[model samples]
Target chain A: MPKLPKPPKPPSYSEVRGTVQDNVIWKSIFRPGSIYRKGYRDTSRDRALAAMNNVLYHLHPVKVKRHGLKLTYTYCLGGLSFFMFILLTITGIFLMFFYTPAAGAGAEIAYLNMRELSTTVTFGALVRNLHRWGAHAMVFLVFLHMARVFYHGAYKPPREFNWVVGVILLLLTLFLSFTGYLLPWDQLALWAVTVGTNIAGFSPVFGDQVSFVLLGGLEIGPETLLRWYVLHVLFVPFITVVFLAVHFWRIRKDGGISGPL
Target chain B: MSDEVQMDQEVYDRLIGEGKSERIARAKAKAAAVRKSKIEEGATLGPKPAEEATKALEEFRSSRSGGGGVATKTAAPADGGGGGRLTPEERAARVSASLGNGGDSGSVGVPAASDHTHRLLALVPPAGIQQVQSKQQDKVYTWPHLLLVEFVALLAAGSLLLVASFFLDAPLGSLANVNEVPAINKAPWYFMGLQELLAYFHPAVAGITIVGAAVLLLMSLPYVDKNPSAKPENRKFANMAFTFFLAFWGILTIIGSFIRGAGYEWVWPWVQGLGFVL
Candidate 1:
């Protein structure tokens, strides 16, 4: 198929100037949010409409001023959380091809798949290893990301809802990782989960009963694997994705990004 | 005018370093040129290199990101894959690699060449950048308003998490026999932070305090960093206190994990420099 050339829109002078003004070179040194267009000169009856249109300017007050996306403080840690998520998704997809949600064959299949990838296929093992490692890494990053947020005080007032959402995300992430462990259907996975759930059993008063409901029996077997598979594959992802959407949206609602201090 | 230019040049030299601005200018020019030429070539050729290049970059990025191909986070090393502890040479290699191999002579050679307009920006004064970039190797950070080092540390943490995940993938071998036990068993990394806390605090405290603290802190981040101290000097106390906490906790955890084999005998508190961890 041949490519079609589209006509370029005629440029507006002010728009062009704005683009030039917004360049990184200019933004870096100039404290952001300052020297910005205060708004259209026309106020009158259109003031409310104008303010509503100015998402960047009005949703959060201009008074909650801060620097742009400085890397060290919040953005970096946030970015780190994002990066780890990407890594997990990549490795996880590849693993799914080899993994089966059966307590009996799941672990055996995982081993076989990995072995085949190593012996027959060249880079397949690397991919699996990378995914496995990435999953573990996400948990650590999430916590550190939390630590950064705490020390920085980014969870106060207007951003409190998002902060709660973030905590849920962290729990969901741990749950996701835990569920994945059971899918391997190995002795270690079974027992670790058994011990892990048993610890859950220690929570409050009715812990053992709670774990039993989850496992669907007295032990970590096929039912447990199935439950874990469902949790990892369906439940956790759904919640995390929804929470993330809300979390990011809240940042916009509260303000673009917080200041560094 | 000449004196002002000299001052500006001096500032630039300080912020990005003497050769860096020139390097950036050259790099930008080279890139524009390369891109313009490629579009021109793509217009004449069968397939556009722009799309192909993007696809290729994405592929490379995904591979580098980790084994996961689930998309959405291929570039975030900490989130998608563990990239902690990049050596200096490794970092240099990464920087040069990111710049990509410069093209041969001509507009098509570098991406910056085809650009028609360039302007001097007073927003980020060259002098300040020069002052900051010059201190690249200095332990005492003199950040010129950009939080590069902090982000680097954050990225390190993120990457490590993913890497830790990879290492501990399917930690339990193939058997759902709740009765079995693996010899060198360990919890997943995130839980390890909690699990490790078990050794330090009583179960009640570990369960309620450390775990609770982490959860509470994460929930409170948006408010925590909402202060107007985007600038480091404005952030000295927060930064130092955080650094101290991180140092104490991080070092203690590392020792706890590695020295686990030594059987909890050598534990030491970093605060007292001796007994706290014990």
Candidate 2:
């Protein structure tokens, strides 16, 4: 009645989204050809550019053999193994924050922390469980992946070196799992590691030296726990990552995802 | 002074006999002398004859176009079209017309042809340059195709793990007692196979020899099996050997994990209850 100024029309969802995507920050984050970029179309050029521009390009090519998309071809074992490794790393890091590596007769901080994880901490027990199960799954998946590669005879010619690298990666995965097995600082952890390391101690020569270095003493003591914690969290993972990089790089270089056979 | 000039006397005399100008004859003779000297020195000639080059280019073009007849001809007619006689402007117009840019004066200026320069009508043979024999593969874009599959796989694995984690708890036995030991002390399930081997073989043999041999054999598989074919039927022996190894290890792991009890003795898992924990 008083001839008041009309309110501005609200922006549509797409309009607001367009404005957000048009900004410098958004453009910087999602480069041209990114699926997330503004005005992205489902074109061959954009699809290829998306893969090329993303960090995933390191692991995947812009196009893959059509046969590789078949679930039966790969069972996605290799990718799952890598994903499991990443999951374990995340959960392991979470566990590491609440737990201590120290262990002895009077000082069993590691064990106490584990108990606290179950009883006191939120999602700690779940993360621990995930880490444990994910580790076991990774070992299994890596074994399956090796078998898949072998059965396909994907190890011939230019792939032979990659297969060797894969073998190294498998061994490293096992070592990572073994080192981590000792971190819970419980009877299961201690005895399991004892049985495993006892096998290592039976190596032809340098047996005692190997055992000593591995256990950090005559037996699985406080020193052994600390040594294994460092190995599990730092040393073995570092080595595994380096080998994993080579393994993945070789997969792409050796002509991407083996064969239709 | 004429004897000291680096010109082929025979070529000079021949061109002179053909009634060529003194400057043109001398220049042609000098080039012929240089070419002869290079040939004598075993220096390979750079460009092949136009006919040979055209043949190679035609072969390459035919192969690229699915092995049909030669595409459009680039070579000028031998008798009628005097490529050498054309002025620079005329040459530019001819090139533009041949390139299907006819009457487009806006096209970039073509480089003027020099007196000695020949028009490049033939391409280097693709085979001679680079023999990349990549067969066309049936492929799909990785974004929606491969990345989608990968994302789904990751989600499936993550959800499975999450559900398992939610229902089950990770085992945590009593504080590690150096004094007392568990009766059924076992390694993790993966190493359980090796531990099972320990019961049968001597420690050194089981731990070092068998394990080392297995790893060495696995690593050397590609090199050892000289079978180039990936077909299962073609590589029967390799497939059989690897299958045997897998079955052997798998059986051992199963036995170690489920069939072992106190004192690491064989016991039915159903009877003794599982002596294993994840």
Candidate 3:
């Protein structure tokens, strides 16, 4: 290829290398500067890059001051809620490899996993059990976390956005618990969900509209299992992940946790 | 103005007076001024629609207006830390710095004894300010203590649930025949509160009001009780009120679960009765 002409540059001004006495304004909105440094190749690193280049990331600081990361400011309950969630996620995935969602086979498969596959997996039942309990624990912890945050006034200023996000997380948690209730495909799961979805239908604004929508029928049937199974396994988890991102980000942006105790 | 500023001003004024120079700082400013004058010249004297007025108000809010004013001057010292924790070296240094060479220095920059004490007290603010009140207030998870508790509790609950699931086996009644009504048709524990409501009130009211009230309380709690004084001792009134509410709801839920007949009308009535009785 033939040599192409270089684009013309702006005319140069006299360079002022040394510090000047006057504070002259430098308007350089057009040409941006590198404002961030790279970090360890973990979560914070992704955050820092995101903070600079992304509004969503910018909402949470890439690197938190060690002081803010301390558990006391976080009110342990929220952290514990997250801990339970991770525990649930791990246990849930393991349960999935063996457990089927089909009404006929779901509970049977779960039983087989507990009796047979569990022996080889060695704490496999422990895993399924943990996942099951973790769901319940998550609901309890999330409620307690909301209470703690509420009483402490931690949900006010700076943390308001996160509080809204937390509400969604709480709803998702309840969803997670409810859906997990059905995985065993037992009567408890069946009735619990039937009652739960019926209550959902009671929403006056939507009412019967809501039940038919979620249950996929006026009453619980094969459709309910498949629906709750999909929601528990796929849908709610996806929504929870999105809200979780906003939740943590808002924490950092809300001034790296609350203090002035 | 300084000599340089005056010189620059006169040069600029002379140039402007001669109509040879123009100055409106940014392109945005120039654009705004032109539009403003155009509007003023052709302005109609009429009341605007509410929506139009709202749009105007929003446009005003979006514009950045900078002006002159008094700035609040409560300059905090570096390291907004209170004087609580102390190192030997720091303590010695601070004492020496305050006392000043063991009284050799005439004016140690210390105030009257009362004033000195007040200043120091102000820094630490007694036990009231420094203490976070409840352990929950600190929110810090001492991992070992917390994790152990979490694991144990979760493990225990998990174990119990598993055993219950196995032993109870969740009563596989007929294959969920919707057409055949199961006698004593009832809701689960979690839904018991609402189901009990459906018995008395319209399902619309039961669903909307009950859940709405609970969600409103939970979500807007931070807004409802916005006091910053969360110290347990300081927040005694709020703490007590909250505790009472929690206890009331908890007691009612348990009781309502059993006496499903009255359908929660008694729950609120009793709570109201207690208020008047007290």
Query: Whose DockQ is greatest here?
Result: 2
- Across B138-212, the per-residue lDDT of candidate 2 in tens digits comes to 999999999899899999999999999899988999988978889989999998899899989998999999999
Clashing pairs for predicted structure model 2, backbone only: none
Fraction of the true interface contacts (Cα pairs closer than 8 Å across chains) found in each model: 0.37, 0.94, 0.19
| Chain B TM (all candidates) | 0.31, 0.55, 0.37
Error of 3 at A86 (Å): 1.1
Question: In model 3, which regions exceed 4 Å deviation?
Answer: A1-75, A104-124, B1-192, B195-200, B224-228, B232-241, B256-278
Tell me the DockQ of each model, to 2 decimals: 0.14, 0.62, 0.10
The C-alpha local distance difference test score for the whole of candidate 2 amounts to 0.87
* lDDT by candidate, in order shown: 0.56, 0.87, 0.57
Residue A30 lDDT (model 2): 94
lDDT of 3 at B263: 20
Error of 3 at B86 (Å): 54
TM-score of chain A of each: 0.68, 0.96, 0.68
Which candidate ranks first by TM-score, i.e. highest?
2
Q: Per DockQ, what order, best first? A: 2, 1, 3
Candidate 3 docking quality: incorrect, acceptable, medium or high: incorrect
